[model samples]
Target chain A: MSEGPGAKVYVFDAYGTLFDVHSAVARHRETIGPSADRLSELWRTKQLEYSWVRSLAGRYRDFWSLTEDALDFAAAKIGGIAPEARATLLDAYRALDAYPEIREVLGELKAQGASIAILSNGSPAMLDAGVSAAGIGDLLDDVLSVDELEVFKTDPRTYALVTRRFGVTAEDVSFQSSNRWDIAGAKAFGFRCAWINRAGAPDEYAELTPDRTLCDLRGLLDASE
Target chain B: MSEGPGAKVYVFDAYGTLFDVHSAVARHRETIGPSADRLSELWRTKQLEYSWVRSLAGRYRDFWSLTEDALDFAAAKIGGIAPEARATLLDAYRALDAYPEIREVLGELKAQGASIAILSNGSPAMLDAGVSAAGIGDLLDDVLSVDELEVFKTDPRTYALVTRRFGVTAEDVSFQSSNRWDIAGAKAFGFRCAWINRAGAPDEYAELTPDRTLCDLRGLLDASE
Candidate 1:
């Protein structure tokens, strides 16, 4: 809550925050069995871990490649996953389901004349496919990716994309994400931030506190008030 | 394996590579019950996670504060920890036991005219305390901490401390760590890298492979030969 106020533009992270990344694994519960939930957790954990590590190391790889690499690690950890099932899961990731309340929340903000866009670690193609699948691409004014900068979110450079795109200072933009790390990153980069703590998880980043924290994106629009 | 060969100076990560981070919990196993091992694993995981997130977010808390913060997270997850036991664990961490072969391996490297140093995320006080307690403080020519740069390892600035201290290029240093993420960072920073796979863990960094992968520090002295 260190920042001054809300912002003119509203930027958000794509995966997990807007889209249900685990929905891909949930769709194949029949073949995956009891380990399905664990697989999903492992996949998502490795995905973010790889991104952070890669970003810190200055070794840039496309998000899709990292996605496949994470899947391989998860599959190996949760016992051997069949190639066919793996392929299906990978395909499903390209079109992850949007969270139930995203459209309503985005629509409310847009009506208030706030600029809306996705600033994500997702590549151009991945973010495009996700927005298209969710049928909410039209709701967003822009879809920005870190691929242009050859880095990932949490890097100040990646957060700079939002300001660079619309010619706004970080204070003029409110960044939102379900990931605690992303919220910390945005807040540290000088943006007003809202942490969507979907699961009511405890805050892990002890140093950086978000401007606002809510149980869902539904609270985000109300926070601007 | 991307580098040409071994390096002039041998730099290492302190926590898991040279010191047994789990020794704190191992000392309290009787009190901790079956959850002792799980607590250790969770503590170590959260400790590293907090450091990475904090570094990427640019919040810059020292490693000691991050360690205590991570311990709080681990304690909350594993029900709760008693204050007396917590005090004991924290004290044990200051003097965590070094690996059995550390002295022998370090001696062999020192005999061959290698420059020995530790470049760790630990604070100056923490690294000095650990090194003194382990009785090998004299074996190292330098003890570098990220506190100088106010950042964590894997940040190129932290790595630059080694080069700046020795007036050598990254190619002149061979960095070793039990943490795969650390290895990726050193390698990406252009140092010849050695991954001490102490636990036989799978390689998580799919993008950059280490120049040398050893079961322990035993293979390292010979690898340079």
Candidate 2:
């Protein structure tokens, strides 16, 4: 099949979609024991929930602080993590490794002339750390953080950063996220979305569909095609 | 206990705090089959997630529509609910059973000279149906729907409705919810909060604590005492 008109800008959600958020907890599995996965799940749940809650309340806390807060809540449930272990896990978060396919996918998008970027709730410092740590900082054209607006993702204003910075309409932007809610929100905000369902989870949001569904970044190129 | 200086207004969260949200699915457990609990869990999760997502995006659909949309999403995950069964479930939702303690607590609060009201993301119609069905309409001084603001709760503006309607500061309003997020939001917005932890779940939001933690409405009286 012929390649359709390519997107002007391709925006990727940073945390679970690109960087493996669970990696931090997984790296310390020996210390965390069997509850590693459960703790990771709860930590992620609280992290996102806090972002939404803070956004709704119009009280913005940077993602780094929010992540720490989520970890505190999750640690409490699992009978707590040692301070040294907690420090190690949090340090690992700032340098979360990208999924195996991320670099190649970004290369392809760049070769195809799509201006690739990240729009995340991560603070500028955290995003910088992740991008540099993953060695992909040179590949991205821009990094947008909701910290500028003191809000979190799924907020239309947060998504508008892409349009303003890239000089493209929402439709001209192709946004990808592993999050069903993020996909729905981006679709509702008029972006051409590619939902990266890495976990093969059932679709749990109605009325809105991403323009594309990819099992991984490898499928992103095909979806764009 | 001398009522300890009764609050100017007692604002309750409608869905899980006052009405049992799972009652609709529970009523038709046979129809929902083995997935009854799972379906109910997903429905409630999606319902709240949609409200927060919509509010963040500034695209507000009434909670009634959001509820149906959430059900659609939930049913899809559970392999879909038939139209007739779906109708039955939705209809049942309109008249959810109030928690056994709700009426008695409202009566006690009223007798103590505290203004009792509901502040929910529910559309006025849904609140009306539940209130009327439960025969507690007369006990409530006012029903505040976030529909007027076209936003969901946790948005400080939604909580501001209490102050606007009752001519009271947030400190004078005692807000209660079974949802931890609601309690945290209310606390952050400056309301004296009572978190009805009916399920005894761990408090996931950090730093913000409810003024009272009650197993049920019976404890509300004691908390005041």
Best by TM-score: 1
Docking class of 1: acceptable
For model 2 chain B, give the 10-residue run with minimal summed lDDT: B1-10
TM-score, each model? 0.90, 0.88
Candidate 1 lDDT tens digits, A1-225: 122234368898989899988999999999998999989988998887788777776788989989999999888888868889999999999999899999999999888878899998898998888999999977898999999988787889889888888888888988889988888888889999899888777777766789889888999866554
What's the TM-score, to 2 decimals, of chain B in model 2? 0.96
The DockQ for candidate 1, computed on C-alphas, is 0.49
> Candidate 1: how many backbone clashes?
2
The per-residue C-alpha lDDT of model 1 at residue A114 equals: 80
Stretches > 4 Å off in candidate 1: A1-7, A221-224, B1-7, B33-35, B222-224
TM-score of 1: 0.90
Pairs of colliding residues, candidate 1: B1-B210, B1-B211
